[model samples]
Target: MHFQFDDRLNSFRQEVRDFVAANLPAHIVNRQRHKSFAPDDLHTAEWQAILHKNGWSVPGWPLEYGGTGWSPLQQFVFNDECAAADAPVFPWGPRDMVGPIIYTFGSDYLKETFLPMIREGRHYWCQGFSEPGSGSDLASLRTTAVRQGDSYIVNGQKIWTSGAAVAKWGFFLVKTDTSGKPQQGISFLIIDMSTPGISVRPIQQMDGDDHLCEVFLDNVAVPVEHLVGEEGKGWTYAKDLLDHERTGSSYIFWNKRELAKAREIASSETIDGIAVIDSEPFRSRLARIEAQLTALEWSVLRMLADEQTPWHPSALASCLKVRGAQLQQSITDLQMQAMGRKSLRFIAPQQMADFPVSTLWPDYLVGKTSVALITRAATIYGGTLQIQRTIIAKMAFGV
Candidate 1:
């Protein structure tokens, strides 16, 4: 498939770049570039609101549903340019996950209620899938929504729910039938955060950030209309949502930005008073990573261009996610190695207040150790490295 952008797409990309450079808050970019972190809710809402105002937030959704109707290549270009510009990554719950699901399966009323708010940055969403014992194997989830007349009383727990603490709504999968087969008994439901028995408790990661959390639903009543797709067919809808998640998880834009950062550090750092970029071993590793990233980017483009009846193999998603996650870890490790002892020293959050302090490394490096520690779990979350390999074996290799 053609990965190169045509003239029109390039123009669109330049437009996006100009917009972000002109409008994205400097503080948000500082948090991303200097702190090596994702934006907080406040920053996310600020940037998202701006993008929504310009109709740039929903490029992948259909135009009727507030999308820009950019072609596949334009979409690719837009994302690449935005990431390269160090734009704050917008909240995904609204644009990436639930928006597409709603457009596809929602009733007109549901679409009217949610799509406008999603487009306007007025609502935030979280995915409620993982439970204590049911993360990877979602079919084993114990969360249940028992139908009682016009509403369903949900009672269960979800763990590792990213952004749940700050989310205003969530799309969840709950067991609605006990007698049917495990996968066949599920149903999808959307719950408002203000619902009576819902509570969110944050889970602090090794990075000292509270991005993930545990959500408890105790007799949380969701109206029957909130169901997506069909009753007892939630498993189907869940699979579709997950497929979307995996397809987008290729991490093309973010990895491209990160690879550029790695290259920048290599170009700047010296080893034994000699430039690290001149070292054969270091150059070889960087070269290999770039090549892999290039291949991964094209693979993503191919999938996007040919999104038709012959579904892209699920194993490819597993492969890209595994490699992308590992490459991120590898790049971070190489940066630390280059920094040497300088990376060992810690930078407390208090020091961040003193911006642009003359440090050997960037402020984000203050928490380099913390970031690296957290990235160690990259191969584990979303699904583990071993699980991805299993998928490759069973699906790709026809084991």
Candidate 2:
């Protein structure tokens, strides 16, 4: 297969770059450039509406379901440009996760009601799969949804839900039967975030951002129609959603851009009367990271090229997740190290206005320390590094 972007794909990429250059808000672009994401509800809505209007909201999906129906390679090209431009991260629940599930399994009525909302940014989604005790071993999730007449009463807690605090809806996996195997008794259901008996509480992270939440379902009632597919088949559907999630979790573009920034910092600064870029050790590190990034780009392209195959091992998906997470943290660590004592000043949100670094460095470096600290969690979310290693062992090694 060809590795080069076709003329059509290149044109699309250029269009995306131009659009982002012209329309992306300064605040959002600054956050992205600085590796900080503070998503305002109204601002995010406006951004997504612009994307939807331009038909760039759903590049990876089928054309019939509001997607652009671009080739996989085109999707890659578009996302690369968006990331480089520091465009708002797509609300993955709609564009990447639940939308696909709905189109693939939900009834026509469900699709008709949800797909348009998803495409138009009228609805936001959160994945309710991992419970307090069930993360890597997702099959152990204990959330229960017992059928009662035409509805199912869900009862349990979901932890680390990324956007539950602001989501309009949540698609969840609940135990419908305990008599069967752990993986067999599950069913996927969509619950409105405003439903009675549902509670959402934010969890403050180390970076001082409440980006994740704990969701409590205390007898929350959901209509039977919210069920996406056949009962007791959520395990299969969850796997599909996760496969989609893992593929994107590589975050290659973000990492590459950060690496470039690191090199720029190195070239601009001097240590002991020598530029960091001229130092042999720092130069060697840059070479290594650049080589790895190059390899990862090609690996992602290979995955897209092989999308026609069924039951592909997804070895590269796991490999890239592991490597990318590690490299992301590594690059941030190097940046912190390069900054020396300049990284020590941790500015809280309240103190951002008076921050001294504003005079010393560009606005993009204001939150560098915080961003580096948060990258520590990259390997844990989207499935832990250990779990990804286990997948690699089984899929790549035939163990």
Candidate 3:
């Protein structure tokens, strides 16, 4: 909760900063500066390998399973430092979302087989939670998996599956029983993406990227051993997973880093013979956003500390989720506004090196427009604003 760090924490932060500076690849830093969603598979694997070598791959996990074994404050400091250095975080599904589930509730076989692969970055994983009809109402999903001899026949479609096209595995929510309530009948399974009858259709975006996909499983055989925990217990496990995810969703570190970049871009670019940041109206907006972001960052520190706070963790997490997503959208809008007409003109990857070399826009503006458009959905993913409102109404207000 303190604004300034103590000696030990400050040293740890410096260590993380030095690691990022010395080890993070140049290509990854460039892609992140331009707001590319993530580094490509090769770069990510290389980065993860370096983290694994140093026992920094999964900071949130138990130490035995390749976690950093850092205190909560250390974890927060690490993320803050990484984002400050423009370093990419490890992929979520393998490191944050599912790895904990396996270590906490999975069989010995599951942990031995998958945790090592995830630690080594040998496979990419995706979530199969949402469907065409089921958006935030994931409990009402219609995808079904029938248990057979040694495997389960999975048949259904999942939309908005991030990284599904390239992910080698997926953790899915499926209707494994129909006689009971919808939430009670659900099960979680890790499906091999290479299985027969499994198909991925990339969802092209305005950003000239295909990070999302529609995954169809038509009678795809998933081994029963891949099921996590127990039958019909996935809803419970999913609740745990979502809690981990939404807690991380505050994204204060990311917002803080990106806000600093926005400040840089505004001060560097000029409009009508004046620096964009010199405008009073723009400063007013930036000032307000900066204040709110500072408050959000403090709230994150408070939650991470796990000390007694006036607000409950669940309610505070929902609050963070709401503000963080909104702040992301605001920052991107500011970036697009700072660039003005230059944001409108775009160039291909190859042309990026030479195009607009002598302009105020600079190369960073190349992907700013696409990032702005895509971030409009920031409030919708993970959990929508409506869902967070529902959670806060229940937990914070007890209405």
Q: Which model scores highest in lDDT?
A: 3
Q: Report lDDT per candidate.
A: 0.78, 0.81, 0.83
Query: After best superposition, candidate 1 residue 99: deviation in angstroms?
Result: 1.0
lDDT of 3: 0.83
TM-score of 3: 0.95
Indicate the residue-level lDDT of 221 in model 3.
Answer: 95
Candidate 2: segments with Cα more than 4 A from true spot: 34-41, 307-311, 349-357
Tell me the tens digit of each residue's lDDT in model 1 across 230-322: 888878876676577665677678778777766766676777987777788888888888888888887777776775534336787887888
Q: TM-score each candidate.
A: 0.92, 0.92, 0.95
In TM-score terms, candidate 1 sits at 0.92
Determine the backbone clash count of candidate 3: 0
Q: Cα lDDT for residue 270, model 2?
A: 73
**Candidate no. 2 TM-score:** 0.92
- Whose lDDT is higher: candidate 2's or candidate 3's? 3
Cα displacement (Å) at residue 308, model 1: 9.6
